[model samples]
Target: MYESVLVATDGSDSADRAVDAALDLASVFDATLYAVSVVDTRRYGDSALSGTEDIVSDLETQANELLDAVEKRADGGVMTELRHGKPHAEISDYATAIDADLLVLGNRGRESGEVIGSTAERIVRFVDRPVLTI
Candidate 1:
């Protein structure tokens, strides 16, 4: 049985499905639920100093809103976290930080469709956790 479940979302519909799945599992196991949204810092594509702060600010705001929605959808206690970094790295690190019993994510994110996203791929490969991709 899972004691702690972490779900990473990019505010996408696919991720919403993952959230639903994570919430269901957590409820069944009476586990703690954690929702994390990471703002990819790789934006701007070039000059890091050019409006980076504004971009990150906007991204974080959006991410927090998404996390809020995820928490709202859960039936049990939920802890939400917002991070800025590589999506997969942040998600994996959070899972380890919380000693999560399970890591749940969607096969694709907001940026990727018709193919598995790179974040899901890396987290599945690098994280030492039981990942359940929906």
Candidate 2:
């Protein structure tokens, strides 16, 4: 029943698992797939601000590279976007901006080895749409 399905990834194993799940759901529903990756700019704060631009640039490069891999793996049609901001906020905002029907996310993100990642939890709290975590 979904028209647009968006999935967020950080190129981690967990996110990769979620990617597969999202892809399957989109395929089954015949929905458009949208992939999103966020480059957290907070990593380059304070004294690191001097090289923040360069770091952000590098992150974008890496993000695009990862997104390319994701596109290839998706097999089906997929649109991708990269943004610089807090992961949860950017993801939620992007979902709303794109008017996605569903959000599919990993149970854990890059830094989270637990049952649930902080970013995913924040997204659940901030986002008004339905979320499916794999």
Clash pairs, candidate 1, are none
TM-score of 1: 0.92
Question: For candidate 1, which ten residues in a row score worst on lDDT?
Answer: 43-52
At residue 125, what lDDT does model 1 achieve? 95
Q: Which sections of candidate 2 miss by over 4 Å? A: none
| lDDT at 13, model 2 | 82
lDDT of 1 at 90: 89
Backbone clashes, each candidate: 0, 0
* Top candidate by TM-score: 1
> lDDT of all predictions, in order shown?
0.88, 0.88
TM-score of each: 0.92, 0.92
For model 2, what is the C-alpha lDDT against the true structure?
Answer: 0.88
Count of backbone collisions within predicted model 2: 0
